[model samples]
Target: MNFESDRIWLYAGEDTITNRGVLVKVKEVLKPRRLRFGWFSKTGWSWLFGSIIGVFLEDFIEGIIKETWLVIVVGIAFGLIFVVWVFWAMNIQTKRYSLIILKRRHEQESFWKRNKDKIIVALIASLISGILGVGGTLLIQLLTKM
Candidate 1:
């Protein structure tokens, strides 16, 4: 099932009559069936990369916002920088993921398992980045007042 198109929509429910994109009928005779969406390997990889980038970008922006109380101009400058960086990073990530996807053809489950470590690392990095952003902002604010 290739769900790489923008027109792809998925719906799963007990009701057989739904105006949703594609309908798959699963009989109760099958006990363990897994239904997945957006598992197109390349698209999934790109989406994961973009989401990881978004998390860090969000933290960076939040840090800048906190500092805006000190200087409006500085905050505006940082915000613009953030926007530019996001665009550049996303472009690079898209290309990188495309290249990787091109080199390998693996089943969805195998692909996920192979990248599970990387995904976990990215998540951890995002969490650390967020904490540092907020903590650093608070530290700076506290110091500036004194």
Candidate 2:
């Protein structure tokens, strides 16, 4: 086997999510600055939407689903979904990274068997931070604005 061929290349490519920033085709986009920026952008938008919904819910609804318990349940469900989604994302990232490694060695495997639990935990942490921080900020803003 050619040793030169057994290498992983990283390059700038077109970003699927954004047109301005160059995509880094690495094993993973593990840069903390980039991840933080993405999280901030995402949370900012969620807060904006949540504030809007909080303000308008009363105006639109005629006392339907007005209980605090219902709202809490909905919020918890949303958090769960977000957590699960992040877990899936982390899994995808790990799989992609493994694939990059495997590709250099000419191995075949679409799914990585290891690191599933770690991914899930990271996802759960992400969910907690995303939901609590964003949701709390939005709730406060909505209360103040309303």
Candidate 3:
């Protein structure tokens, strides 16, 4: 058995979520910046689960069912169900999204700015909890001392 190694030069790739600039190596400075996996998350769960089950699942299920028309019907039913579920889920999921996107203006607002009121309430709750914990400890100490 023989092992081979290849020499590679570092090239810049754009940041996905933030749309930020990438680091360029000295050798790559003159070359145009390249985008690799620009749209997809590297090492995301979809990739992991797809690798494990996605590629062969349709064939495997078809083999079990063993009817062409049934397979088509099942596929259509699954597709319809998936579409409906996604449509339903979008509302619930978007409601919980940390950042808000204004569709008309095409502006993304940070969660912190939009929910300042919630942040203030959370801060007050934490402060009250801390005070109560300290006061309770002090009272327990006083009772034990008597």
Candidate 4:
């Protein structure tokens, strides 16, 4: 992680006796949102089904009833159903991804990308502080001499 590379090597587990760890290769890295939900992907199935059901329900309501109050009530009921499905799907995804991540044996903070900006800013600040301290000492000495 401290090392700079586009693809970082993952080392999992070490035996105390052997002092050896397995160097793991990351097959692919993904941002949780950036993860592609392809046609076959299960993560978005609930949402897809919810939308489909909504369309069918809307058409059915429009066909059977002309009353506004009744339509609103039906819409609310379907909304609850969609909410439950979405949460259920999300829960499954969270569990699956969490288990995979845990197996990698990396801490939560380990995912934080390394950037030169942080090191550059820190170096600049330390240099400026050191220069200021030295300058102040020289100024005090000159004043004492005067």
Residues 95-143 of candidate 2 have per-residue lDDT tens digits of 4332123253245443445667788999999999999999999999999
**lDDT of all predictions:** 0.53, 0.52, 0.52, 0.57
**Predicted model with the maximum TM-score:** 3
Model 3: how far residue 143 lies from native, Å: 0.4
The CA root-mean-square deviation of candidate 3, after full C-alpha superposition on the true structure, stands at 19.5
Best by lDDT: 4
Could you estimate the TM-score for every candidate? 0.30, 0.26, 0.31, 0.28
| Span of ten consecutive residues with least summed lDDT in model 4 | 1-10
Report how far off residue 5 is in candidate 1 (Å): 20
Candidate with better TM-score, 2 vs 3:
3
Worst 10 residues of 3 by lDDT: 1-10
Candidate 3 local lDDT, residue 45: 34
Query: What clash count goes with each model?
Result: 0, 0, 0, 0
lDDT of 2: 0.52
Model 1: per-residue lDDT, tens digit, 39-115? 33234555665676566665556766786444555455555765665565555445432111223244445756879
Q: Identify the runs in model 4 with alpha carbons over 4 angstroms from their true place.
A: 1-41, 53-67, 96-146
* Candidate number with the higher TM-score (1 or 4): 1
Q: Output the lDDT of residue 12, model 1.
A: 60
RMSD of each: 16.3, 17.0, 19.5, 18.2
